[model samples]
Target: MAESKIPIYGAIGANVAIAVTKFIVAGITGSSAMLSEGIHSAVDTFNGVLLLVGLHLSKRPATAEHPFGHGKELYFWSLIVAVLIFGLGGGVSFYEGIQHIRQPEPMRDPTWNYVVLAAAALFEGTSFLIALRQFRGQARGVPFWEALDRSKDPTTYTVLAEDSAALAGLAVAALGIYFSHALNMPMLDGVASVVIGVLLAGVAVLLIAQSRGLLIGEGVRPETAKAIRAVVMEQPSVEGVGRVLSMYVGPDEVLVVVDVDFKDDTPTGDAADAIAAIEKQVRARFPMIRRIFVEASDAPGGDASAARPGAAS
Candidate 1:
């Protein structure tokens, strides 16, 4: 989690610089596309700060109010970033575009706009590469898209999406400024602003949808669950593995509950020892699983009912 935060810090620095330049150019040139890009960068800067706060909050130890720690705080903030992207960034861009369409203004110093945009694109591309590298590490041997879909971390994906959109917006803005000047149709610049807003809204929707699942208690990856089952079955004192339930409570924290049918003739003392051994082995095998519950029964079909709530680790 700490290592994953570098991208967010990088983004904050890059976006703050880019946004200041963008706003200055937008004011000087009166380019709708440039104004839209400024809004995008400003919102991204704020979102980076929010991610940092969320990361810090999520790392807080479990408290009386939050027995599982503040892990979901990150998800909550991620959701807020999505809403801000759609509301403040996308909505304002769309409104500005429509106003510009109704009342076009002759741009001043178009060359400066080009220079600033080029620089902004360079910065944004670097940030995108950083996020892409981390994402690729998580992707491993699997398909990139599939890995992203299954990723448990929200900060990396948000930064990646923002930077990718930033680069695309720069391209669109450049084209809009160029064509609007050459063809003497300033409405195209307004159209470009509208496109940027639509793009942001779409990205926001994607983030919101993905984060919603995670906030609502998404389970561990398929492989993690399978490995857990394997671990439980490998125990000598266990006759059969019943059910294994798992969920992610934090970025790197997992909660696992397992039910096992022990050997029928095992004594009470031996069963207690077996439970202790299983817990130790499971924790050693999967260090991320901080909270674990193991239930023993006489029959494989014995209803473990549901896991009893225990103190979070």
Candidate 2:
């Protein structure tokens, strides 16, 4: 099944609106924490743009050079977006926040900052809900952090993480603003800004790590591996499955490669026919499995080390 881009587009709109409001409020109130949060949201908006572009390009049909399709391109561009958020957005905010901490400015007009933070939180929360709704089945069996790790849908993860962190940062900023104003301490606002920056940086690092694995072509999970193996072994002529390898080629698709052993008496043509039938069966059964290659061998459970990349006969 092809992944939908609706949630990501909605996230982008939310980020734009939140970023504008936060920046304007930060400027009006001169709150370092609010400013840092604003910067984070701005970067999130830009990242959304990158994700949308990647999603569009990744949908293209296979070409000669990339016969498997351009699905992994999503990971590459998402990684680029993560790096920019880490360095440009998170890093810059952290540095500025530190500087503000050193020369603290009195927190002025806490009320307006908190109100804006509340509004931003509401917007980000809505975006997060949309992303979660879209990812319902995809993240079902996985833990939260592990889901992010195993997910091939970069845009969805990005939206979820950015919105969640935005909400948390708003809370932190609100606390900092309140304390600094209530206690008449100028340094607290800067400290809150620094905390928000660190949080953003941490989230960016996580996104980078997840995207990097996809770019390098990580294998499918144990459950998926078992399913592919079972499907391949069900063929009549096939004695057993040797090694089954599958990788996420897109958000909702995988490329499956399997090595199968045939009966000793199996003729070359018979083996070929069996292989074709297994491939067709597997594809028909699993919509998420987009491509398959099956190779026949006489040896039972062919040598693990001898497994070639494609369907070998």
Candidate 3:
């Protein structure tokens, strides 16, 4: 959790500074793209605040009402962030672009636009590098796309995606400003704003999907499930391992319920011992597994059908 905050803090600081500069420049230059960029930075600043709030809320202790703790608070807030990005960031930018197109404004000297953009790029780039480094450390050498697909935490990736989009939007704004000034076609500025909106929308949609999955209780990776099963099978008193049900209750916390078949002749006391051993081994192997429930069955073949309806043999 401490690590997650590093990138978010960096992003918030950078976006706040950039947003103010962008709004000032947009006011001075009357460039549609610059205005849109200002909105984008402002939206990003707000999103960063929301993410921080979510992170803090998610640290609350578990209560009877929420046995799994408040981890999903982060997911819920992340989803809200995505929605805001779509509505406020993307929707507003696109609308502003269309309005500018319908009533084009005369182009002004773009010197300030270029200056602000260059400075924004520098700050945004620095923030992006910080986020990328954090994400890479978390990925632990996993390929980029694959790691992103498997990531349970939203903060690092969300910042990464936002920064990446921001960089791209800056490029488009630069081009639009250049072309509008060079060709004396102010409508081109509006086109650039529209493109930035579309880009933001695309990124928001992806974030929404990812956050939705986590909120709905996504499970561990297949390889992790397989490894857990292997650990149970290694126990001498165990006959078989049944369904290895698991869910990520928090970024670094997992709840697992495994169906274990102890040898039919094993006494209840020995079975209990084996269950304890199983829990210890699993926790030792995977510290992220915070809570584990072993459903032990003494039946031959370790069948758990009686204990869990629809449980596989």
Candidate 4:
């Protein structure tokens, strides 16, 4: 969890500096795309702060009111960040773009816009590389989109998404500024702002979907569930493993409940011992499983041989 902070901090720093620069440049150049970019950077800066707050709150110790700790606080805040991206970042940009298009302004010299765009790209690119490196470490060998879908930590990926959008927006802004000046089509700058808004909205929608799923409850990956099932079935005294229910309680915490059927003639003491062994082995294999509940069943027709491995609820 601590490692997740590195990229977020880097992003916050870059966005803060860039936001100030973009706003100043926008005022000087009256470029609609530059103003939209300024808003985007400001929103990103705030989002980074919110993410850090979420991370800090999520580290709070569990209490009676919330037995699972405050882990989901991170998800909640992530959801908020997504909404803000859609509202303040995307929605505002769209509005500004339309307004600018309706009342087209004269094209100004794009020299400052070009300079700021170049510098913003440098900072944003560096931040993106940091976030991508962090995400790659977590992804191991998994493909990019697949790993992003499987990731539980939002900080690294969220920063990556934001930086990607920022870099893309810079490109669009540069093009808009160039075309508007060269072709005497000032409305093109507004078109660029709208495009940037669309990009941000798309990114926000994806983040919202992921954060919502995690907040509701997401289980471990299929491979992980299968491995856990195999571990349980390896016990000699165990007859069958039923539903292996699991959910992520936090980025690094999982709660698992397993239904086990011991051999019909196995002694209660032996079953208890088997349960203990299963718990130990499962924890050893997956340190993220913080809480485990094992239920020994004696009901008739308890055969789970036909049950698919890791088909947990």
Provide TM-scores for the models.
0.88, 0.88, 0.93, 0.93
Which regions of candidate 1 are displaced past 4 Å?
A: 137-143, 299-313
88-141 per-residue lDDT for model 4 (tens digits): 999999999999899989867789999999999999999999999999998889
Please identify model 2 stretches exceeding 4 Å from their true place: 1-3, 137-150, 299-313
| Candidate 1 C-alpha error for residue 121, in Å | 0.7
RMSD to true structure for each model, in Å: 3.1, 3.8, 3.7, 4.2
Worst 10 residues of 3 by lDDT: 304-313
Q: What TM-score quantifies how close candidate 4 is to the native fold?
A: 0.93
lDDT of 3 at 126: 99
| Per-residue lDDT over 1-313 for candidate 1, one digit per residue giving the tens place of the 0 to 100 score | 7678988988998999999999998999989999999999999999999999999888898779887788888999999999999987889988989998999987766999999999999999989988888889877787988888877788899999899889988999999999999988999999999988998999999999988888898887778778877876776777987778887887778888877787766666666666666677777877778888877657333433423333344
Query: Candidate 3 at 154: error in angstroms?
Result: 1.2
Best by lDDT: 3
Q: After superposing candidate 3, which stretches have Cα over 4 Å from the reference?
A: 299-313
Per-residue lDDT of 145-255 in model 3, one digit per residue for the tens?
Answer: 998888888899999999999999999999999999999999999999999999999999999999888888798889999999999898888888889998888888888
* Model 4: ten consecutive residues of lowest lDDT: 304-313
Candidate 4, residue 181: Cα displacement in angstroms equals 1.0
lDDT of each: 0.85, 0.78, 0.89, 0.88
lDDT for residue 274 in candidate 1, whole number 0-100 = 67
